[model samples]
Target: EPEVTQTPSHQVTQMGQEVILRCVPISNHLYFYWYRQILGQKVEFLVSFYNNEISEKSEIFDDQFSVERPDGSNFTLKIRSTKLEDSAMYFCASTNTRDRDTFGSGTRLTVV
Candidate 1:
């Protein structure tokens, strides 16, 4: 099985600050996505990228959030300003087909 790598297993940030989460999907994957899970809540989709452009994004991915696929290898998620409500476990996922997906361990974001 291949792996999706995410950096900074944990992140601590202050409210109103900016932060960027990084991910590297499997080399062969063509689809990449960002999802967030609150401590006790279900996973929520943030954005999806394919062919270097954003394919889809959820309402939760508002103006403050952005995704980028730079150099055809790294997939990144950036939050312009951190909020207490934005603190969660952010996961990076990738898939070559609709059958299955591979996810990274996730970055635990803590806001103060």
Candidate 2:
């Protein structure tokens, strides 16, 4: 089965640097999203993008987070300024419909 792939399963950065986490979403899907889970916290939606624009974004998706589909297959999330609070597992997901979403294993970001 095809799946979403994310690189650098784990990253440790200083508190204010920019970081770009990469993902390759499943082919033939129409919607894409970014979700994050702080340690021991529930998964929370960050943003969703489709048809080259944002469909929805949670409050957590402040100015710090941005999503882009740089090409047909690659989806990326860039954090403009990292913070200690940003330490979490960032998951990339896609769905043909809202009910069929699939998530990547996730990239763990740790800001020290």
Candidate 3:
């Protein structure tokens, strides 16, 4: 089965620095998204992108976060400035239709 793929499986960063999380969604998928789970906390929605524009975003996706589809297959989330609270497992998901979404294993971000 095809799946969304995330790179750097894990990343260690310093506070106040920038970090880019990368993902490659399934070839045929049309919608892509980013979500994060802060350790034991529930998974929180960050942003969604479709047709090369942001379809929707949550409050957590403030000035600190941005999403982009640099090419046809790659989707990226950039954190302009990292914070301790930003440390989490960030997941990438994609789907061609609302009923079927595939998620990557996730990239774990550790802020030190």
Best by lDDT: 3
Candidate 3 lDDT over residue span 9-91, tens digit each: 99999999999999999998999999999999999999999999999999999999999899888999999879999999999
Scored by TM-score, the top model is: 3
Candidate 2 lDDT: 0.93
Residues 30-66, model 1: lDDT tens digits: 9999999999999999999888899999999999999
Name model 2 segments beyond 4 Å from true.
none
RMSD of each: 0.7, 0.7, 0.6
Candidate 1: global Cα-lDDT?
A: 0.94
State each model's CA lDDT, in order.
0.94, 0.93, 0.95
Tens-digit per-residue lDDT, 31-60, candidate 2: 999999999999999999999899999999
TM-score of each: 0.97, 0.97, 0.98
lDDT of 1 at 91: 100
